[model samples]
Target: MPEVYHLIVNPAAGHGKAPEFVQNHVVPLLHHLGIAFELHETKGVRDAGRIGAEILTTTSFPVKVVIAGGDGTAHEMIEGVLKAERDKKDQALGRWELVILPLGTANALFSSLFPQPPEPPSEPSSLVSYLSDTGPDVLYQLSSLLASLKSTTPARRLPITLTSLESPISPPTEPIQSHIVLSTALHAAILSDSEALRSSYPGLERFKIAADQNLGVFFKADVRLIPPHSGKIKQYDPSVGNWVDPFTFGEDTLSGPFAYFLSTTTTPRLEPSFVISPLLATLPPNPSDPPTMDIIVLRPLRDPAVRSALASRGDEAASETWKSRIRQVMGWAYKGGGHVDLTYPAHRGETEVKGGGEVVVETFRCGGFEWVPTDAEHEPSHIVCADGSLHTIERNGKATVQVMDPGHDNSDDGFWVWA
Candidate 1:
């Protein structure tokens, strides 16, 4: 029998160009290749997941799921995969491989694997800028990519980021899966706030407006960062240009009045241009290695000067310092991913330093992490973003995020992505 394909296309995804692209581009290509496929256009929220679940139940052999939408639609398909796996009591999840059509605002997962994008336009493109500034050019670029794909191409298994929220009385909140990111603090707050303004602002500008609204909002949490590869929990030192051992401080679990805490798996960015975790971009993931994610954390208390300044002045002043530092470091993201290499004077209430300074961002290469929220009552702190979907942690509850892969043992099951 010939290979079969199932497609989930979301018309509302990615500037409303998906439906047209599916009709004009995708269908023709599959037909030309003599492929047998089934296509379903998403009608409402979670429909894609439902459809994907239905597809999973009906199909037995290896099948391809071609999702032509945004990150949200891709998320639904994964959720469907999880649900189907549970319903059928299947241990493996590898039967279905996926191909993204990249028709969403972020298209974050798409940008991660294809970092520089497929074709080099006359003008250089950044994922951040691509999502921020969408136009015919992007469509053309993506079309160029679709045209280049071969039907016989193989899909690679994607490492997963699983997040579980703690609940004492009832069953634990269902763990969320993240192919792209699992974030809290500033980034999560931004995603939550930006959604409300999405109608008014429309486009990436809403995110900027939302950031302005949530600036200086601190999150208090107890963090335990565990490295995927055993040894000491590694912390990047820009001065030495190496991942030095954090164990020298004689501690593992860290307490903080955190300003930002976010983790990414498989992908290196939240946006093509907004390369939040620059370390992952420079250090590529090895297929043979165990699945892992890089975390970018900012805690004001880690800085002696900032801590003293906050006590003497107020959180507002300390916040200003943090905001300035984040802005400075992120600017480097646009250059050559210099943000991860940023350092600051930790003793003088300083935020940014050019050379021979202590690292400002607490970078971690970890297998998993537990975030016990100190300010769960604080709305922003309770918000957790798993692949742009928001979930709230209950009061006194916590969230544990981890990265896992099949690693040849469960290779027959798990999620795979086609570039």
Candidate 2:
């Protein structure tokens, strides 16, 4: 325990329920523990980041920050602290321990850090029910946080990705740091559209609505994957239940009308049940491990059925067919990230095929990647989502992402989380 814990509360999070939760549950618990805390309520967008920077710059090492909101709030605060640390060139900075209280539409980071036990097999259900059924609620998460704080539980360092947009026509934008996810293509489009539905659908249903809207739309781009330091880029092979080289010719680049492209660092699931990158949880990264991100890729052209349909039936019909396939993949993702194991049959005519074929979803562990939109007029392809916030890559612009190593030189510095 530090001198005093700084509580950054996002009042508007969880459909305006965060402040109420803090008052009803968090405050009383802190009082019971005899812990001293200072409360700071966010007034508007990015306020938490401002508050976080202020606290970090004005305080000493080994500070504790209890964030009472969702992934977006946490992202902002981390960005703030990181920026502040970078700016303070003359002084040595200290570690900031984050205690997440999951109070938002999707508590991706919090749920990932403290995952619940696997649920039993069940039939497919609505998005609302699926989200509601999975993961621990605020009360459960709070208790876990309290337990960790009370015990000898050591803090875990967080790995982050530094993303920047490069363009010849326009000036460069500041590099953005993302602790959870950085994505383009379908995932980016869904996040971009979901904000519009936030008012109508306050819960995770908005993401589903956004997914439906963007499912038929394939993004045109060129991707280049970079290998991790002291390691080669490896792709997950469902057949062998292991990783291997993705390309036969040893090329590191891919051309795409990509169906889905998303990379994650900390969290395996974007929502409570949507396990987009299951390996992150199964093979958690160590502080000394080379910096790498887990990427989930889906290309409609890779499927022979989809390719044949595109050549014979044309774009619209092929798109409709692809939508069904995407829905199937999403169903698998909700079922403990079973999508990674999906493979197409070898022969297109094979009706009862089981084992051998190209994998439908490609999973990779790599240092970083770059995405360049093939067409300037392809508006959807230009969108990028870092954490929950959205950004647009200018025409002729490309986005580059690289994972940063969480150094172990000093135990008092860098971001840490109370698991």
Candidate 3:
């Protein structure tokens, strides 16, 4: 246990349910466990991060931060701590741990860390029994946190991605650190659009609506995959059921009218059911190992069937076909990230085509990647999302994303999570 638990609560998260949940459930549980804590509520955006930095800087080593909110709140807090570590160099910033309470719309980090069972209980049980026996299905994360608090096991180290904008047209900007995801193309557009719909939808439905609005749109960009510490950029070859060096010929740049391009560090699912990167969970990374990002790329033109369809059918018909295909891939993503294994057949017809040839989706595990928009006039292609927050790469600019080394040397003290 730490000197004290700094409970940072975001009242606006989960459509204003976080505060109530913290009071009714979390507070009582902490009291029951006889843990000393200080409560702080966030008034607006970035408040959580500010409070987290304050706690980390002022408190002693091995402090505990209980975040009673969603991924955005957690992201802000982590950013605060990381920023403090950068700025407050002379002062000793003690090591700390994060405990998450999934009170947000899309608890991506929480869901990835403590995934729910595939099947529910066969028999119904009382609320008390459920809490005592298996834990609340929805509130099970809290139970996991509490159990960890009582155990002697060390917290798990969390690897984060550092995303920087490199612009020749403008001066250098600050690098953004993300614990969950950093994306462009469709994912960035969806996150960018979904914020506008938050007031109206205020739930996961906003993402769906945003996806509908941006589904047919294709983002043009030049992507380059940087090799890991091993000096090899490995890609998942579905045929071999393993990762292989696809760029052995020294080709790393990928030209694309990309449909979807997203990368994840700690999370596999942005939503509970959305398993965008299933390998993150099934084949987890070791904390002591060099950090690498799991990237999911969808380039519709790479599929020969779609290409033949495009040449036979006009742009409008090909657009519809690709949109339908994207939708199908998304459906597969929800069903245990099945989209990754989809392959294209060698042949095609004028009518609708189903899978069976070269792998349609390109999945890679790399240390970093760079995204450069091909057209300066196309603004959507420049949009970049770092942990749900949106950014734009300037004209003739690009974004470079790399995993930060965690506590590899004496100069750095990295982050960890109470898993």
* Each prediction's TM-score versus the true structure: 0.87, 0.88, 0.89
Error of 1 at 295 (Å): 0.6
Off by more than 4 A, model 1: 90-92, 116-154, 196-205, 229-232, 247-250, 346-354
Number of backbone collisions per candidate? 10, 1, 2
Model 2 steric clash total: 1
Model 3 pairs in collision: 344-357, 345-357
> Per-residue alpha-carbon lDDT of model 2 for 63-148, expressed as tens digits?
88888888889888888877877788865557788888888766888778777645422212322342354334543657435544
* Model 2 alpha-carbon miss at residue 232, Å: 2.4
lDDT of 3 at 37: 86
Number of the top-ranking candidate, with TM-score as the measure: 3
Model 3's TM-score against the true structure: 0.89
Candidate 3 or 1, higher TM-score: 3
lDDT of 1 by residue, 209-266 (tens): 8887766667877888877853345777776766778731346687877778888877
Deviating ranges (above 4 Å) for candidate 2: 91-93, 117-139, 196-209, 247-249, 349-354, 407-412
Candidate 3 error regions (>4 Å) = 118-139, 196-206, 247-250, 349-356
Best by lDDT: 2
Looking at candidate 2, the ten consecutive residues that score lowest on lDDT are 119-128
